[model samples]
Target chain A: MSFIQRAVKVPPNSVSLEEARHRVFDFFRAACRSIPTIMEIYNLDDVVAPSHLRSVVASEIRKNSSVTNPKVIDMLLFKAMEELNNITEHAKQRHHIIGQYVVGHQGLVQDLGTKDQGASGFLKDFYKSNYF
Target chain B: MALRAALLRHVRIPAQTLNPALTLTGGKWGPPSLRWMSSHDDHLTKSEVTERVLSVVKSFPKVDPSTVTSDVHFQKDLGLDSLDNVEIVMALEEEFKLEIPDKEADKIDSTNLAIEYIYNHPMAG
Candidate 1:
């Protein structure tokens, strides 16, 4: 089991409060990186222009205005983290991590919707494999 | 579509109109009286500075402001942990258009305190 996961229960049943906190934070950190990874993969060259990206990013940041379901956030966070953990490539890791952070975060990810195949299909594939 | 929607949503919240409480005074940002209050409000009047804050802060569907009060600690009383604080700060800043330096932001314990700060702020006057 991962060093971090060990703090939680074995067999992945119940996570300690402390472990849960770390898991939430670590999950956010890793998922924040996932955005650019998908961006680079899809090669939307200048797809989301910097100026446009700024607005897009702002909406993403504003996603967590309400303290919506923390459970959903945690689930997504863990799912995103798992995706980043599985990647073997070198250059893509950075992008993957950043994307993960943006989408995984509370407010930032809210503005961003999962319309793009890059985020949904590919990213989902990453999450499903790792979460299991 | 999602990106467009998110951008539009943020664009809708005019920062200057933020702090629904302070709007009555027709000013933005906060006043200086805020530095005097305690860390949290334990008791006060119906128009208690903090209670007024709760009235409006809770209006937003996303944030349940009912839990707020003078004694309502920012993190504990209100469900606002950290990011919520950041968002509230942003909303407040946008409403008042005043830079609540991180130092002062930390001092804002209740809605009343926030109102006091806005009331006496140089910008408010």
Candidate 2:
């Protein structure tokens, strides 16, 4: 039996230059506003300041000046959204100290009040090798 | 063309050697010139680190400043949970302008530990 491969269809560019520009500007503004909160939650305030985040985003926007191509703008927007999602996820994970400790321990000990168990045999072996 | 070349030559050499010359040239050339004048006062002493660490610990809403001492532990003295401890470490990292590695960060359970870490860090400014 012969397998047929279908060509991926590229979506038509429907967004106007003004709309794309506005979207990019809005994305930057939203990202800038959230930088402080993201930094606080993710413990990145030391590494990344609000102004630094803004300048970085500004540089990215300036680097890509293909406003005429809506697809390019869409790709940029999608990347920005993905970045925001990643930061948010990191912040959420790192916001609590317990999670940080558990993660740092290389998942040896699982959390309390949770049925999720770690590698109990490995943990035993670790204790035997290290302690005994 | 000759005059412009001479002017460029006059501006370029002094800009590289002297900051004041660069500033003067920068003023003349508007914001187009890339004369990066970075100030060099980014060193923090041990005493400053101690003070900053104390301040950061004290600033925690749950922690009482009157009861807080350098030797006080986050969990035992301040009654802070692990989350609070993480936040405190993060605050110290922000205050000291340095990244405390996960292992070291975990070990910083007390104000004194945080102070010592920040004080020893060469890049903490």
Candidate 3:
């Protein structure tokens, strides 16, 4: 587990967007490197491959792609790093990992009943992942 | 060159006389004729490396398998984003069991580059 112990030091703020973009890629690589240990720790091999988890991490980063501010990107990256640390440390349970990442946002609640089939798109979108 | 040959003759005469004596003494040391091998000899061939590299690039979910070629760019030809590019490089690393440095990894944007990098890598087994 000593390998999992990363330097959690706070790097100085990026002076420009180019620097911030580099930091994001560095963080993304770090997260991808840890997927093997994360899979072993959470017993995710049965449901997900490393590539799928890699894409999931990328999608999570893409979710905040609209934010152009370097400071905001830094903050989001810090939060993402903290989440990755908690996950690699086994501070989370198997179902937590499954529900949050593997099963995806829509996999959590699927209304199989025909009664909701006639529901408006807005309601369905709201039920899916909060935002329309 | 003549002086060097004369020196070699003198050294070889002693070594020839000592070889049987050393072997008769049951010494652990062996003659200089023995050869040692290292993992360097277990290198992957260029064709095999290229084939595996292409397979890895084609397997990426967002890549159209048919559109993939040795010279196709991940972003321009395959239409993948930067993240997908990184993901593909990571997949190649996993396949070859080689940890490419970040600087070199960022440079591998196409199948040809990936194959060339992995093929030239001494420890890419």
Q: TM-score of each candidate?
A: 0.32, 0.38, 0.79
Which stretches of model 2 miss by more than 4 angstroms? A1-132, B1-42
Candidate 3 segments whose C-alpha is farther than 4 A from its true place: A1-9, A118-132, B1-38
Q: Which lDDT value does model 2 have at A64? A: 74
Q: Highest lDDT among the candidates is held by which one?
A: 3
- Choose 2 or 3, whichever is better by DockQ: 3
**DockQ values of all predictions:** 0.02, 0.01, 0.54
> Pairs clashing in candidate 2?
none
Pick the DockQ winner.
3
Better of 1 and 2 by TM-score: 2
- Per-residue lDDT of A42-108 in model 3, one digit per residue for the tens? 8999999898898889999999889889999988888788889889888899988888889888886
By lDDT, the better pick of 1 and 2 is: 2
TM-score of 3: 0.79
The alpha-carbon lDDT assigned to residue A81 of candidate 3 equals 88
Model 3 agreement with the true structure over B1-125: per-residue lDDT tens digits:
99999998888743345555466345467544343345667789998998899888888888778998889888898888887888899999889988889999999998989999999998998
Clashes in each model (backbone N, CA, C under 3 Å)? Answer: 45, 0, 0
Return the top candidate by TM-score: 3
Cα lDDT computed for each candidate against the true fold: 0.49, 0.63, 0.85
Fraction of native A-B contacts kept, per candidate: 0.00, 0.00, 0.69
